[model samples]
Target: MTIQILSLRKKDLDKIIEIENESFVNSWTINDYINEMTHNPFAYYLKLIDKDSQEIMGFVGFYIMFEHAEISKIAIAKKYRGYKLSKLLLTDVIKRISLANCENITLEVRVSNIVAINLYQKLGFEIINTRKKYYPDGEDAYLMNKNLREED
Candidate 1:
């Protein structure tokens, strides 16, 4: 299946919410997403859609501050697992940020999320620190970082 990456639109919120619910137990509310799209200057959200099925396969959201980008959320549909969708999203995000002249990129992933942690590592992010009970449900988080200078 061919996947298309596009800037997220207002109409894609419900499908994105479905993917978010399927991917995370601690999902963001619809209003949180709506607010991010409107109020956040640093934010850029991308939706991955299957060209044939025409359904949203996944999404990646991030924000760019002065000289850095912070990954906010990434989730793929449960049925669409085992593909390199996350890699594509991350690489796309990194590439976009570089073009925008960002210096660093970071994200916090639950320490127990080995799959995601591994993916981030493979994408050049290094563990910088850990946050205790970061999740509302008390799960700890690992703060990962990647500097664009290293990509040079």
Candidate 2:
């Protein structure tokens, strides 16, 4: 399947929410996403679309503040897992953000999400800290970070 990464649009919110609901135990409300997309000046969101059918397969959202960027969310549709969609989406965003002079990129992943943790490590992220009971379900989260200024 051909995949194309593009800036997230208002039109993609419904599909994005569907994926978010299926993938997360505590999904974000529509207004939360709407506020991020429409009102948050620091936020940057992107969507991965199937080039053939124009279906949104996944999305990544982050906030860039000067030299630092924090990834807020990244999710793939339940049916689209196991295809490395999240990696593709994240790598693209990292590149885009780095180009914008972001030197530090960070994200928090559930402590139980081994797959995501592995992916993040493979892409040069290192676990720096942990947020105790970070999730609504009282699950811990590993805070991972990658320094864009580091040697390739």
Candidate 3:
């Protein structure tokens, strides 16, 4: 299947919310997405689409300020997991951020999410610190960072 990565748009939000709800325990509301799209000057988001079927398979969102960027969310649809699509999406995001002259990127992941932690590590992210009870459920989170400047 042919896939395309494009900037997130208003038309994609419904499918994004669906995937977000399926993937995260505390999903952002539609209003939250709208505010990010409309009001947040630093926020950036991208959607992965099945070009043939016009279906959104996944999305990634982040914010950039100065030389630093922070990943806010990423999710692939339940049916589309295990195909390395998350890797595809994340690698693209990193490349784009690097091109924008970002020095580093940071993201917080649930400490128990081994699969995600492994993926982040494979992408050159390192666990730099931990946040106690970072999640709404009181789960600890690992603060991971990828230094794009070092990669250059």
lDDT of 2 by residue, 15-99 (tens): 8889999988888988898998888999988889999999998898999999899998898888889988888888898888888
Query: Each prediction's TM-score against the native?
Result: 0.96, 0.95, 0.97
Best by lDDT: 3
When 1 and 2 are scored with lDDT, the better candidate is 1
Ranking the candidates on TM-score from highest down gives: 3, 1, 2
Q: How do the candidates rank by lDDT, highest first?
A: 3, 1, 2
What are the per-model C-alpha RMSD values against the true structure?
1.0, 1.1, 0.8
Put down candidate 1 lDDT per residue, 1-152, tens digits, no spaces. 88899999989999999999888977888899999999998899999999998899999999989788899999889998779898998899899989888889999999999999999999999999999999999999999999997678
Can you list the residue pairs that collide in candidate 1? none
Query: Which of candidates 1 and 2 is the stronger one according to TM-score?
Result: 1
- Pairs that collide in candidate 3 are none
RMSD of 1: 1.0
Model 1 CA deviation exceeding 4 Å by range: none
**lDDT digits (tens) for residues 8-69 of candidate 3:** 98978888899999999998988999999999999999999999998999999999998999
